[model samples]
Target: MIRVLVADDQAAVRDGFAALVDAQQTMYVVGRAATGRESVDLARRTSPDVILMDIRMPKLDGIEATRIICTDPALQRTRVLVLTTFDLDEYVYAALRAGASGFLLKDTPRAELLHAVEVIAGGEALLAPSITRRLIAEFASRRDPQHPSPQLAELTDRERDILLLVARGLSNAEIAGRLVISPLTAKSHVRNILRKLDCHDRAGLVALAYENGLISPGDQP
Candidate 1:
């Protein structure tokens, strides 16, 4: 079963989400929190597989809570899915930087929300190609080209190419077809890149691609 925790300052939204998740036979809500700090505490206690976190909360913010949970060695298996009001906005990006596995808009369809939880729980980051492009565009101009991450040196030519494909929002199957390799090979390369860069998921890789100057704003995917 996929263990989940719901965190939002609003009681109605929090309870509603918990109810929705509990309705699924494949998943269950382990806890609910009205504040970010409570979310963090509950997470340590429950050790849930996924957390649906609101970006804004009292006593602390979801982004900071996500950071704290993700960085904790004991909670390494926990993945955070940020809830936002906008698509591909600054808050979502900040949450991703803080090690969130993915994000969804607050008004996302119920089916999609459940699917997103499953995907992140299964260790895949949910970033559609279109959303990835917009995320890159949203922060391209503000990127500090002069201070690229030194971790770029850890990747080889093939890995660099793969990273660019990931930044373009290509799936492992798509990348395999594009590069004339098996899907498993593509998946392996992606995993290697994630390990080399110390990233939590594909979302982090997309962020790193831009932050390390691999993919720039206005660059065609």
Candidate 2:
């Protein structure tokens, strides 16, 4: 079973999400929290596989709580999936940087929400291509394109090419089709890149790609 924790300041929404998750045969809600701090506490206690976290909460905000939980060595297996009211929420990037695997709008269709939880639980980050482009463009505007992460030098030419596609929001299967490689090969490359760079998931690769100037605003996929 995939253990999950739902964290939201609103009781109704929290309960609704918990119910939806519990209905899934492959998933179960381990706990519910109404505040960011409580979510972190529950996360540590439950060691859930995935957390549906609200961005705005009492006592602590989701970003800070995500950072706390994600940075904790004991919670290393936990992945946070942020919940926001808007697709283009300003705080979403910060949550990703704080170690969240991905995010979803609160109004996301029930099926999509459930699928997102499963995706995160399976160790993949979730960001729609459109959202990825717009969000990265908006945030990358403030950053210098010349700034680069030294660790990027460790990547091979093929790995660099794959990383660029990943930052453009291509999934393993899509990347395989585009590069004429097997899906397994694409997945293996991604896993190696994550390990070499110390990233939590694909979302971290996107963030790293931008932060390290691998791709910049207005770059074509």
Candidate 3:
């Protein structure tokens, strides 16, 4: 079963999210916490497959908690899926950098919430397409397009091409279709890109691609 720990300062949110997850046959709630510190403690004690973390919490914020848990060697297998408000793009990027596997809006549909947990537990990062373009653009603005990215030299021509598509927010299957390669081949290439780039997940690579001017806002695959 996919074990999950819900961490939100609000009781109603914790209970609601836990219920939704429990309704799923393949996933279960292992614990719940109302504060980020408690979440960190429970995460270490429970070692759940996924932690549903809220960005704002008492004592410690979810971003710090995620960072702590992610840096812990014992919790390496654990993935953190941050819960946040739609306008909190700042927190979203910060959490991803803190080693969170992904983030979901607080008002996400129940089905999507369950699916997100499963995705994170299964060792994949996910982002809502609604926020992706804005996110890329936000970082893209800070990027010095004229200087060129130093990290670009680390990739082969094909790898660089793959990174560009990834920045466009295409899935592995999508990438495969675009590149005329098998899905597994596309996924493998993505994994290699992440490893070679030393990124925590696709989220980091996406930001890196835009921050390095590899992919521009509204670019198609």
Candidate 4:
């Protein structure tokens, strides 16, 4: 089962999320916390598979909590899916930088929310398309204009191609179709890219791609 810990300051939100998570046979709500400190404590104690963290909580905020949880050696495998009410909340970016696996709006559809939990738990990161575009734009604005990292030199030619497609937000299957490779191969290349680049997931890949000018903001794949 995919164990989940819901951390939100509001009781109603926590209860609602717990109910939704519990309804899924593949998922279970392991614990709930109404404050960032409690969330951290529960995460350390339960070692849940995933954490649904709220950005704004009393005592401590989600970004800091996420940083602490994700950086903990014992909880390295615990993925944090940040929950926010605003699509472009500043804390969302901060949480991502702090190693959150992904961010989801509190109002996300039940199906999508469930899928997100599954995706992150499966060692993948997901971003809503609109949010992804915004992230690209923000990254573009903040890019340092430095030359690409030496790590890019370590990627094979095919892996480089796959990285570009990933930065463009194409899934492994889409990349497979475009490159005429099997989906498993495409997925493997993506994993290799992440390891070589020392990136966390697709979002980190996208950030690195834009920051290094591998994919331009005006260029749509």
Candidate 5:
């Protein structure tokens, strides 16, 4: 079973999510917290496979909690799914930078919420396509153009192309179709890209692509 921890400042929210998550046959809620610090503490104690974290909380914030949780090399398999009110905003980006696996809007459909937790827990990510594009554009425009892309040197020309496509928020199937390659090949390329770049998921690919200048604002895949 996929062990999960639910964290939110609201009692109703926590109870609601716990009921939904725990009811799943493949997952269960191991604990719940009402503050960021409590979430961090419970995470270390519970060692859950996934954490459903609220972006804003008293005594600490979800971003810092995620950072602390991810910093421990032992919790490498522990993925964080941030719950937020905004989509692709700076708070979400900051959480991503802090090593969160993904983010879901507070009003996300119940089915989507369950699916997102499963996706992140299964080592995949749940990055919204529109959010991906916006975040990339925003980061690329603000970051220095002169930023060194040393990681690109570790990738081949084809990998570079794949990375650019990922930055453009293309899925593996889309990448395959665009490149006239098989889905398996496209998937393999993405997997290799992640391994080579030392990324956790597509979110990492997007962040890496933008930070390393592999992609720029207003650029099309």
Candidate 6:
């Protein structure tokens, strides 16, 4: 079973998420927290496979909590799925930059919410197309052309292709269709690309792709 932790300042939200997650036979709610600090504490103790975190919390926002949880040596495998109420919330972008596996609106359908948890738990990143575009624009607008990173040269030709597609917001299945390969093969390529580029997740890959000029801003997939 995939262990999950739910964190939200509101009791009703936490309860609702817990019920939805617990109803899934493949998942179990191992813990719940109502504050950012408590979320980190529960995560450290339970070592859940995924965490549903609220972006705005008292005592420390979800972004900082996600950073701490993800950076912790003992809890490195715990993936955080940040929950927000708005699609254009800037805090969601900050959470992603802090190593959150994904972000979802609180009003997301139960099916999609469960799937988001499962996807992140399975080591896949999730970001809505609109959110991805917003993040890309935000980063692009603030990016400096001269920033240097040696991780760019580590990618092979095929991996570079996969990275470009991922940056274009293609799902694994979509990428498979585009590249004329099996979904499994596309997934493997994405994993290899992330490892080669030293990226934490697909979001990081997208940022790197744009920064390195692999895909132009005007390019559409």
Assess the local accuracy of residue 16 in candidate 4 as a C-alpha lDDT between 0 and 100: 97
Model 3's number of clashes is 0
Residue pair clashes in candidate 5: none
lDDT to native, each model: 0.86, 0.86, 0.81, 0.84, 0.82, 0.83
lDDT score, candidate 2, position 67: 93
Best by TM-score: 1
Backbone collision tally, model 5: 0
TM-scores, all models, native as reference:
0.91, 0.88, 0.86, 0.85, 0.82, 0.84
From the highest lDDT down, the ranking of the candidates is: 2, 1, 4, 6, 5, 3
Better of 2 and 3 by TM-score: 2
Candidate 1 ranges with C-alpha deviation above 4 Å:
217-221
Q: Tally clashing residue pairs in candidate 6.
A: 0
lDDT of 3 by residue, 1-221 (tens): 99999999999989999998898899899999999999999988999999999998989998899899987889988988888887447877778777777677888888888888777787743556447556656746765778765667889889988888887778888889999999899989988887788676777778777777777777765
Regarding lDDT, does 4 or 6 come out ahead? 4
lDDT of 4: 0.84
Q: What is the lDDT of residue 176 in candidate 1?
A: 93
Provide the lDDT at 128 for model 2: 62
In candidate 4 the C-alpha lDDT for residue 90 amounts to 69
How many steric clashes between backbone atoms does each model show?
A: 0, 0, 0, 0, 0, 0
Identify the runs in model 5 with alpha carbons over 4 angstroms from their true place: 170-192, 195-198, 216-221
Pick out the ten consecutive residues of candidate 6 with the lowest summed lDDT: 124-133
Residue pairs in clash, model 1: none
Summarize candidate 5's per-residue lDDT along 73-110 as a digit string, tens digits.
77878999889887757877878767787778889999
After TM-score superposition, the amount by which residue 15's alpha carbon in candidate 6 deviates from its true location, in angstroms, is 1.8
In candidate 3, residue 142 scores what lDDT? 69
Expressed as tens digits, the lDDT of each residue in 72-128 for candidate 4 is 889978989989888777678778767787788899999999999998898743566
**What is the alpha-carbon RMSD of candidate 3 to the true structure?**
2.4
Candidate 3, superposed: residue stretches over 4 Å from native? 143-149
